[model samples]
Target: MSDRICCPLCRCAEVLLSKAYPEQAEVLALLREHGPMTASEIRAKVDKSIGVTAINNRLERLRAFELVARTRYGNGWKYIAKPEVES
Candidate 1:
């Protein structure tokens, strides 16, 4: 059986995003609240338990989900949360 929960009234994408990993949600919130930020910057602001590599992983996953986007920034990359989709 699938591990994800489904709601008949919700959009598929919205349901998937709602079920995203906690770390991914954190990363998204940081970008939305603080504007674009590098992985290193996110690492510094995220929970101490979340490491640099984990931060990078979450960023990439969020990107794949189209919930976030990245751009070249200095020598590294900066990520920002995509604008929320209207219901």
Candidate 2:
């Protein structure tokens, strides 16, 4: 089929390292600490210094790379670390 592969953690790292996005780094660290979390939850845990749109953008990138999975949690989205990458 195709030769392209997706990786969220790598994408996250690339983006973060490319521009030194502090928010991205903070989010990654939070994810590592708390395991999995929704965008709103992460924002809250991170002190809401960054806006929702930025958080959403980062989450989208993470999801695309398959680094995280998004699921419906009641009325909002819940993000969890992909089990395959836990190691």
Instruction: Compare the candidates by lDDT and give the number of the best one.
Output: 1
lDDT for each candidate structure: 0.76, 0.66
Worst 10 residues of 1 by lDDT: 1-10
The C-alpha RMSD of each candidate to the native structure, in angstroms, is: 6.0, 7.6
Stretches off by above 4 angstroms in model 1 are: 1-20
Best by TM-score: 1
**lDDT value, residue 54 of candidate 2:** 81
| Model 2 Cα lDDT, one tens digit per residue, 1-87 | 111214766555546544665555566556656877888889887666787778889888767766567888888788775654321
Q: Could you give candidate 1's per-residue lDDT for residues 1-87 as a string of tens digits? A: 112224543345544565767667667777878889999999999788878898999999999889789999988899987776544
| TM-score (C-alpha, index-matched) for candidate 2 | 0.61
Report the lDDT of model 2 for residue 16: 55
List where candidate 2 sits over 4 angstroms from the true fold.
1-22, 84-87
In candidate 1, position 83 carries an lDDT of 72
